[model samples]
Target chain A: MSRESVINWIVLAGLVAVPLWAHLSDEPFTITLATRAVILALAAVGLNIALGIGGLVSLGHAAFFGIGGYTMGILAHHAQTYTPVMEWPLLIEGTKSMPVIWGLSILFSALAAFLIGLLSLRTSGVYFIMITLAFGQMFYYFAISWAEYGGEDGLSIYVRNGFPGVNTLVPIQFYGLCLVALLIVLGFNAALARAPFGLALGAARQVPARVRAVGLDPYRLQLLAFTLSGAITGLAGALFADLNRFVSPTMFSWQLSGELIVFIIIGGVARLFGPVIGAVLFVVLEHWLGGLSDYWHIYLGLMLLGIVLFGRGGVIGMVAGRERSHD
Target chain B: MDLILLAEQILNGLQFGIMLFLMAAGLTLIFGVMGLINLAHGSLYMIGAFCAAAVAGWTGSFTLGLIAALAGAAAAGALIELVVIRRLYDKDHLDQVLATFALILIASEGTRWVFGSFPLFLDIPEALSGPVMLPGGIQYPLYRLALIGAGLGVAAGLFLLIARTRIGIQIRAGENDREMIAALGVDIDRLYTFVFALGAALAGLAGALVGAIQSVQVGMGEPVLILAFVVIVIGGIGSIKGALVGALLVGLTDTLGKIALPGLFGLFLDPAQATQVGSALASMAIYVLMAMVLIWRPTGLYGVRA
Candidate 1:
């Protein structure tokens, strides 16, 4: 079809083929790396909905990511210890079922996003960026001090959470599950991009006055996008925690949020497979350059600077040319 | 419970706020004039602390070390502005943020590579080391008191420079209209470099002053940077007066909440639970304050209505 779509297909094929090749060759580390990239890409895709589509530059997606991780951590922690999550109002039992945890994670994160968006959406531009960051820091500090759930030291689960008929303990199986999640989300993203809501949201970003002139509520549209964005990211977070078999306050750190943005930027902002390309490149570079020196971040910084300065539309842009349409 | 302890905490809050003002003022000025968000401002703070520590250790003169800090950070700031930040002036906040973020990674890793992992320590000078007796027999660290005086003095100096000097007029003019000032024959590039260095110097001074109280370490600037961001947001971006008020408000809220919240909670809850909950809420107090401020006045207390 189009050059960009061709590239997207090839990228998707490579993501699946690499992990399968690693599994066949008994290279578990590569599979783990692939899994990490997939999870991170999923998180960035969530961000892409707000950022690329709605033009909302949020520096606080980590809050939802952490919420998802902690959801998994708190529930699975209780499941492992056989303790009820709460007993004050009503008994809430901890669950190790991936489906349940995912649902709760999505629900909680969406609720949090709705509240945060209600407040944050009141501001725009640089204020929006700083406010979202402050919100992230708020969650981070709360996580660190809420000592009941392991606090700063974090919580570790001995066994991985279960998905039906899938031995997730095997790295490849887990990677496949993440890939499926990514693919499903990507499909949704593509559909949403073409949908009327997406069109209105895109309009709201470019010209709020015009969006209002057409009787559409820009704020409500953005808030909905932000909420959905948080839900998907929350799902990725649950998956990420399960992959690591641990959850920590570090998940909420501003650095993680920054890295998520970096993934979007590196892959090609608003491109369908941009996050996928960006995340894989980031993981590969991190693995490759990390082995070269302890101070590999210096090189990473230099590369990022070069990209921002000269490389306008990132890797996808360089290869596929400019995007066909603004949406 | 004790009035003296409360008074001392208030003083500590003031000192902290004033130091934060040093950081925020520079940040606000740069943002107001250039419309650039420099995430690496904190890295300049770290550089100042490191330079001060290294020089103080070598020359056995704290004053000289402070001077070295000022010069080093200014030079670094000017160099960065000339090389990287200069290109970003016309870019969007996203590009500005990413580029400056890259600078932070480079500065931090480069500092770690050169200084190694261990934190460098700067000692309080002999003259400012001991406690000073104040009104009502309150004893406070001379160094901290000096920090308050110095921060205020710098604040005053900044106000004067902006209010009275020839460059001050130009700076104020530039903030309102950049192209007009350039068209009026002002050397806009040099002025920008000068302003960036001035902001850098202020941050460096804060770093050097605070470095004595805490360990001079890499990544230390980030937390302070975030706090400074909160201050600017609360004060309304691009306003010096807003930065001052916002900085003090954050500092007081943070410091007082840490102590008062626990005591308040302890009145109702068990001591351990009170402490945990109080401390947690205390940590979040400033953010809550920021949120409330935004709700009340989206443009900030002193910000001109957008």
Candidate 2:
């Protein structure tokens, strides 16, 4: 195996081992933290597809993230309250099933992403970033004003949604589910990175004119990548809401979008396991530094500033030595 | 609808647009001159507000407060440019974004550390506190009118400085060709610092002016910052005239939409649903305006092709 592959294995193993150890040692909080890392890793992995591979620096992924969270929250809410989500021409009922929520979250976010991508893909660079941010703010303000579900206050699920034959209420069980989801997405990401489509997308990112010279539409390729990226992030958002048993408009905030980008940067942009490493490190830092003081963000800021200024390559890049060939 | 009420809303929109122009002008200038996207610009706005509030509270003089705001934000902007932003001018947009984002965290928490969690209040001066009758018999706040006048005055001054002054010539030259200007014996580094400080001073002035109407608080700059981004984008980045027109358009659209949309919707939908839907759409009006503008002219109405 390659050096990076070996490190990836070590990181994955550590991810699984820590929560197992936490469960055995009766540290439920540790398991929860690990779960948080895994879900965040999953979300960042989603972003990596666009940012890392397609080079689309989207600042609106929070719109999808919030869509996913609201999907779960709204569905489970109606289920608990015994109300149908829609009772019009075609009756639609709420579901407490995790699989159903995930499917709907992925579907809704993918649609939103497709539409957002269609318009946003027309522009590149800073315009793209600002447009995406504008779209995110659109969703954010919509959420805050759309009081049918919950306005600025947010909605909550009374109980964890059920998965087939698993007690998701248990912290360790939920952690396993999230870890498996993350690993599956990571594997898909790995496969896609080597696939023909991923190659074209990467080419489009590096040299769009050349990609176009070859008779392929760079815009279409990017739109597909953006859609898939949004779908994955949407799934992670559902899982995150389930973890917390709550969803809020804060999910749609631009700050969350910025944090998602931070994860990709800190992990090593474009690395398969970069987001995984970054997310875990972030959670650990938050926990550790948060214990030290209330103004931990100042220290966090300094660290981020230091990294951006001095360390071009993230942790994975620092260890694995400069992403040999973008393969 | 009363014509007088409509006029009042229009004036309010103009005031808001003027404030946004201050922020957007600074942003466009920096982007044009430095080729850097500084997210920390908002932090400088917050600094101005905080400084104004603190100084005003201590000395009981709003004029002193506004001056302190300008000085404070300009100093902070210069320090940041020297220490951090200078390094980022050559980096990619992504690096610039990340570094400035970090500065935001540092600035925000640092502000909180110094000022505590609660908001500080800044009061309008006695002279500009009350309302004045306008040409149409409509009453408007004197302070807001002053803000409009002041903003327009600054805009005029900026135009003069850019068009008529030696520094303005250098700035315009620097925008066109940095190396050419530097080769002509200009101190490029100092010019950059001065431009950045000028932008920061504008933003600080805006923050102090706005703080009189709203509570001076942490995280307040972000919303306005995003709006300013929209303005610049719609105005076409790197174009001062575009920034001005775009800011005014956004400000008017946002203000009028909030009041007009609900009433318009009330014509079709139930009052309750109209209010809800109208408010939601109103909130998104400027973004919709941006999208439409982009659709029509990808480079913006006045923007040069990128």
Candidate 3:
């Protein structure tokens, strides 16, 4: 096997081995942490489709994320009450099944992504970033105002939405579900990167004018990637809601968007498994530093500054340098 | 709505717009001259508010507090410009964004550590505390009126400085060609530091001035900062004239939309349902305006195309 292949295998093995050991030992906290890592990695992978392949610096992925969470929350609320969402105009009801929630999450996020991406993708550079941020805030304020859906206080799920025979309330089962979703998403991301469309997106990122000159509209490709990215992130948001059994406007906050970017950057932008490393390290640092004191963010800020200044490749890049150099 | 209420809202809008202009002015100047996007511009605003609150609390004088805020923000700006921002001039927008974002974290957390999470309250001076009657029999807060005056004064002063001053001439020249200006022995580093400090001072003044109306606290600058970004974008990035027009337009649009949209919707729909839909639409109104403007004129009203 090649060096990269060996490294990939070892990394994958370590991922399974660590979680498996935690599961065997009945360490709920560790299992929970691992589960969160997987879900967050999935979300970051969604972002990579736009940021890495499409060269779109979206500072508003949290909108889709919150949409996913709200999908679960709104649906679960109706499901628990056993009421149709809209009895007057249309008979739209909530679902108890996870599959239904996931479907809705993807569809909702895809639709939102299309609308936002249409306006945002009109501009490039800093303009795009600012517009996306504005749109995210718009959704955040909307959620905050819509008191029927819990508003600023947020909504709570009475139980884990059903997923066939699996009792999702169990940490191990939920973690397993998250891990599976994460793996599938990762596989999709890697395959997409090597796919013809992915190649075109990458080319557009490198040289948009050149791509345009060659008779391709970069905008359509970016919009498609952006939509796919939103759908995947929406999946993660659904899982996150289930993980916490709560949904709030805070999920859509710019701070959350910033954190997602931090995850991708700390892991190594555009690298497969970059967000994975970033999410794991970020959570681990938060957990560790949070245990030490209430003022952990100060130290976190300093550490981030150090990383940006000195360590450009993030932690994974440090461990695995320039894997299979292309040039 | 009554004419008094309308007039009051307009005054409020102008005050808010002026504050945005103060923030956007510096941002536009920096971007125009340096081609850098500093996300931590908000941090400077926060610093100013904190400085004002702290000074006022210590000395019990609002004027002194305002001065301290300006000086502190300008100093912090100069420090950041020299130590961090100077290196970012030649880098891509992404690098500038990330680095400045890191600065925000540090500044925010650092402020939180120094000052607890609870917001610091700054009192308006007793002299300016009461409402003054305007020409239309509308009662307005004297402090808010003062802010509007200060903003206009700054605007006029800035226009003069940029239009006629020797340094302003150099700045305009520098914006056009940095290398050529530098070759003429214009101490580019000092010019950059001065410009950065000037921007910081403007943000600080806005923060301190607005602190009277709002709470002085960490993260307070973020909302205003975003508004300022909207203003600059709408005005055309790197255009001072654009920033002024954009700020006023945004301030009026946002404030008026919040009041007008709900009322307009209520005229037809039931009050409760109207409120629900109108508020949502109002929140989205500015963005819709932004999108319309972008579609109509991508470069902005006064901004020259990049």
Candidate 4:
């Protein structure tokens, strides 16, 4: 295998192996930490499709993330209470099935992305960033005002949602599910990077006029990428909410969005496995530094400065080497 | 609504607009002249509030507190400009955004470490402690009226400085063609630094003025920062005139919508339900307005579309 691919495999193995060992050793806390890292990586991977491939710096991605969380929250809340979602619409009932929640999460977030992208993608550069951030704020305030389903306080799932063959209440089993999900996402991300759609989006990012000259609809291509990106992120959000058994408005905050972007940056933008590395580093730092001081963000801020000012290629670039670029 | 209530609300809107203008003025100036998008501009506002609160609490004089706020924030802005911003001038907006975001984390955490999580207090000056009657028989806070006057005065003074003075001429000239003015022996660096400090001072003044009414706390600047961003974007990013108009429009729309939406919804729904839904929609009113504006004029009202 090539050096970069070798590094990628090593990273993946370490992620899986560490959690499995932790579970085997009865270190459930470590398993939870690994689980959190995996879920955040999944979210960042979704972001990479739009940000890395399409060059869309969506500052409001937390909107979809919160959508995913709320999807799980609303559904599981009803299921726990033995309530139907609604009497109309053929009496749709709540479900604690993980697969069902994941599907709805993807569907709702995709729809939201399509709508937001429609208006927001009309503008580019700073306008796009601000518009997305504004959209996120709009959703955040809406969630806070949503009186039912634990508005400002957030909703809690009494029981962890069930996976078809696994006892997901066990931390390791839940971690395993998340791991499998993340592997699938990573595989999808890698394949998509080589796919025609991804290549076309990359082209559009660099030269929109040239894309149009080739008789391609770059707008539609980007919009589709954004929707898929939202779907994946939404799925991650569902898993995250599940892990905590809680969903709150903070999931939709701009800080969350910024942190997601930070993952992409730290991992190496436009590089496969970049967000993975970034998320791992972040979760680790959050764990370690959080224990050290309440003002740990000071250290994080300094680290971020060093990375932005001096550390190019992020952790991925540092370990895997600079990605060979053609465009 | 009664005329008195309406007038009071309008006055409230004006006060809010002026505060936004103070924030946006500095932001727009920095963008217009330096072509940098500084996300940490909000941190400077926070610094000002904290400084004002600390000084006022220590000395029991709001005027001294206000002075401290201006100097502290301006010094912070200058230091940041020299240490971080100049390097970013030739870089892309992404780099600038990320770097400034890092600064925000630093500023916020540093403040937290010093002051703790609890909010600090800044009392309204004793001279302007009570409500004053307006011409329309509307009672309004005297401090808010003073804020409006200060904002207007700043606006007028800024216009004169930019329009009538020699430095203003140089600033305008530099804006149009930096190299041309620099080649003529003008110190561009000093001018940039000066302009940045001026912007910081304006933001600090706003923070100190508003800190009396609201709790002076960490993270308080972010909401105002976002609103100021909305103002600049609506007014066009680089135009002071645009910032002013956009600020007023946003201030009015946001303030009025909060009052009007719930009432309008009550006509159709029960009072409690109306309130929940109306407030939700009200919170989103300005975003909707922004969307409408973007659709109509993508570059904002006065911003030239690229």
Candidate 5:
């Protein structure tokens, strides 16, 4: 393996090993923190496929993220209340099955992404960013005003949903579930990055005219990337809601979207495991500094400024060295 | 709707739209001239309101407070441009966004550090506190009328300044060709700083004026910032006239939709369901409107294809 690959392996091992050690040491709280890092990493990784590779600076990925959370929230809420989700064409009851939720999360978020992407792909750069944000705001307002599913107050699932064999109430079992999901997604990401679609998406971002010269429509490529990105993020969101056993409108907030972008930037944009490293770093900082001072965000802001100003390569870029080429 | 109520809502919409214009004009000018998206722009608005509120509290003069807001925001703008924004011109949008997002964090926290977490209050002047009679015997808040009037006056003045003066000529020239303007011996750096400061002052004025009607506090600028973004997007980035038109449409649509949507729902649904659905959908109307506008004109109504 190359030096960068070595670093990636070390980072991946550390991510799994550290949590395992914590779980063995009976530090469930630490495991919870790791779970958070994994979940957020998954979400940010989804964004990286679009933003870093596809050159789509989406400011509204939280809509997809929220879609995931709400899907889980709605299903679990309805299941607890023993109410059917729909009764019109055919009766459909809310389910607490993990596999079913994951499947539906992917479908719902993918469909939402497709519709959102259809409109947003027409514009590029700043217009694209603002339109994405607007759509997110629309979803946010919709959630806040839709009182049936707890509205502004949010929904809660008293019991963790069932997976095939695991007792998800066990902190380590649940953490393991999330970690497996994250690893599978990470593997998929790595494969996708090396695939033909990745090459085309990267080209579309760097030089759309050239890509068009070669006869591939950049818009369609971007839309596909967006849809896939939204789907992965939506899956992460479902996992996150399961981890927390609650969901809120705050998931759709622009701040969450911005933070996701921050993760990718800090970890190293376009890198496969960038968000994994970034999420770990973020959770560590949030936990440690949060204990020390209430004004930790100021420090975060300052650190981000320093990174943007002085550290272009981020952690992986700094340690593993820069990639050979990019726009 | 009653004619009187409709007229009142229209005026309210105008006032809101004008406030948005003040914010959007500054934002578009900066984008056009600098090719930078300063997320910290809203923080400057917050600073303006905070300065006005604090100064008004200390001096007991709303006029003095407004002056402080203008000076405060301009000074903040100039400093940020010199220290932070000047470096971002050649960088890509991602860098600009990250740097500016950092500035937002620093600005917000710093404001909280100085002002404390509690919201500050700013009272309207005694003279403009009451309502004024319009042509159709409609009553409106004098302060709001003055706000509308002030916004329009500033809009006109800004248009004239951009179109008429020597500096205006240079600004327009710089927008068209920065390299040529600099080659012609114009100080590009100073001009940029001036433009940024001018935009800041406008945003600050909006904040100060609105602060009187709403609570002045940290993060107050953020919602308005997003709304302003929506306005500029609808108007077309970098076009002042687009900003104006976009602002009016958004403002009127928002205000009127809030009223009309619920009533429309009431026609078909029960009172409770109508209220819930109407308010929810009304909140989403502007975004839907933006989507439609973009579908019709992808670059926005007045955006130059770049």
Candidate 6:
């Protein structure tokens, strides 16, 4: 077997081992934290597809994430109140099952991403980055002003949304759900990256002229990749909401989007396992540093600066040595 | 809306656009001359406000405070260029962006470390504090009018500096072709440093000027920075003329949209709902304008195609 496959297997084994240890030892807190890491990693992985592979440099992935969270939050709220999400005419109503919520969340995030990508993708480079940020800010302000839900205060889900035969509220069970979803998304990402479409997407990143000379519309390919990236990220957002049992406009902030990029960078972009490693390291650092002082962000900022300036290859690159030649 | 309210809002937009112009002019120049995107430009604005507030507090003179702020920010800009930013000119936009982003974090935290969390208050000087009567039975704040006057004066000064001076010729040459000028015996590094400092000073002046109207806090430059980015993007990356027109357009659209959209919507909808919708639309108006501009003129209004 190739080195990457071996390493990938080892990592997968470790991921399975963690939850097993948590459940066997009845360490609920550890299980909860691991679950949180997985959810965040899923979000980062979604961002990786856009930023790392497609070179989109989106600074507004948070909009898709928040849309995902709100889909879950809105559905759960309706379910709790014994009300239908939409009672049109006399018979239509939305369901609050886990599968249903996931589907809706993915759909909503993808749709929003499509609309935003349509406008934002028209511009390239710095203009693209700024436009995405502006749209994110636009949605953020909209959420803040639309007080019908939680407004600035945020909305809480009292009970974890139900899944058949599984008490998803149990930390271990939820972690299992997250792990399954994470694996599926990561597999999709890997497949997509190697697929013909992903090749076109990657080609667009390096030279649009070459890609265009090959008879493919770079814009359409990029939009598709962008939309898919949004959908996966939205799925992560739904899981994140379930994990926290809450959704807030803070989820949609540009700061969060920047952090997601930071995660990919720190772990090593374009690698399937990069976001996972980065998220774990980041949460651990934040937790440890947060305990040390109130000014942890200052230290975190400095650390990130040092990493960006001196360590472009990041942790994974350090371990893996110099990069492989894709060309 | 009443005609007076309409006039006031337009003025507000003009004032905002002018403030944005100050920030964008320096930014566009740095980008045009150097091809570097400095996110820490906002930090310079923040520093200007802090320096102004602190100096005003110590010297008890707003004019002195403004002078100190300009000098201090320019000095800080020069220092940063000499020490850190000079290195990044050869780096990619991502590297520049990340490094500058780090500077923002450092500058913001460092400022807070010195100034504490509470906002520093800079009062409007007595000479510019009161209301001034305008021609159409309208009264506007003397300070805001002064800001408009100051902005126009600076614009004129910038025009003169670029048009009628040796430094202007050098700068224009540098912008057109950095290497040719360097080969022709200009001290390119020093010239760049000076331009950066000049831009920083303008940003600082803007900060101190606006600090009286708003809170002078560590993170105060961020919102304005983003708006300035929008202004420059709409104006075109490396064009001062574009920055000027773009800033005013954004300013007027933003300010006037907030006032007019609500009133316009009120004709068909409930006033309260219209206010909510209008305010949201107003906030988004500048961005929409930017998008439309990009759609029609990809290079911006006055941006040379390159």
User: How far in Å is the alpha carbon of B30 misplaced in model 3?
Assistant: 1.7
lDDT by residue for model 4 over B1-306, one digit each (tens)?
A: 778887888888999998999999999888888888878888999999999999999999999999999999999999998988888888766667778888999999999999999999899999999999888677899999999998999998988998999998887887778889999999999999988888898888888999999999999887788888888778998788999999999999999998999999999999999999999898889989988888889889998777
Interface RMSD of 2: 0.9
- Candidate 2 clashing pairs, residues 3+ apart or interchain: none
Per-candidate DockQ values are: 0.84, 0.78, 0.60, 0.68, 0.78, 0.48
- What is the C-alpha lDDT profile of model 4 across A144-171, one tens digit per residue? 9888867799998889999999999999
lDDT of 6: 0.85
Name every residue pair that clashes in candidate 4. Answer: none
Which segments of model 4 are wrong by more than 4 Å? A325-327
Here, model 6's chain A TM-score works out at 0.95
lDDT of 1 by residue, B71-167 (tens): 9999999999999999999988888878898999999999999999899999999988999999998999999999999999999999999999999
lDDT of residue B79 for candidate 4: 97
Task: Output per-candidate TM-scores for chain A, rounded to 2 decimals.
Answer: 0.99, 0.99, 0.96, 0.98, 0.98, 0.95
lDDT score of residue A241 within candidate 2:
96
CAPRI class of candidate 4: medium
Per-residue lDDT tens digits for candidate 6, residues B63-85, read 99999989999999999999788
What is the descending TM-score order?
A: 1, 2, 5, 4, 3, 6
By lDDT, is 2 or 4 better? 2
Second chain alone, TM-score for each candidate: 0.99, 0.99, 0.98, 0.98, 0.98, 0.98
**Model 1 CA deviation exceeding 4 Å by range:** none
Candidate 5, A129-162: lDDT as tens digits: 8788778878998999899988999999999999
Residue-level lDDT of model 1, residues A1-327, one tens digit each, is: 788889998998999899999999999999999999999999999999999999899989999999999999999999999999999899999999999999999999999899889999998988888888889989999999999999899999999999999999999999999999999999999999999999999999999999999999999999999999999999999999999999999999988888888898898988888888999999999999999999999999999999999998888888888764346
- Compare the candidates by lDDT and give the number of the best one: 1
Residue-wise lDDT of candidate 2 within A229-319, one digit each (tens)? 9999999999999999999999999888888888988989889988888899999999999999999999989988988999977888888
On the 0 to 100 scale, the lDDT of residue B252 in model 2 is 99
Residue A274 lDDT (model 5): 83
Q: Which ten residues in a row have the lowest lDDT in candidate 2 chain B?
A: B297-306
> Tens-digit lDDT track for model 3 on B42-115?
99999999999999999999999999999999999999998888988886665677778788888998899899
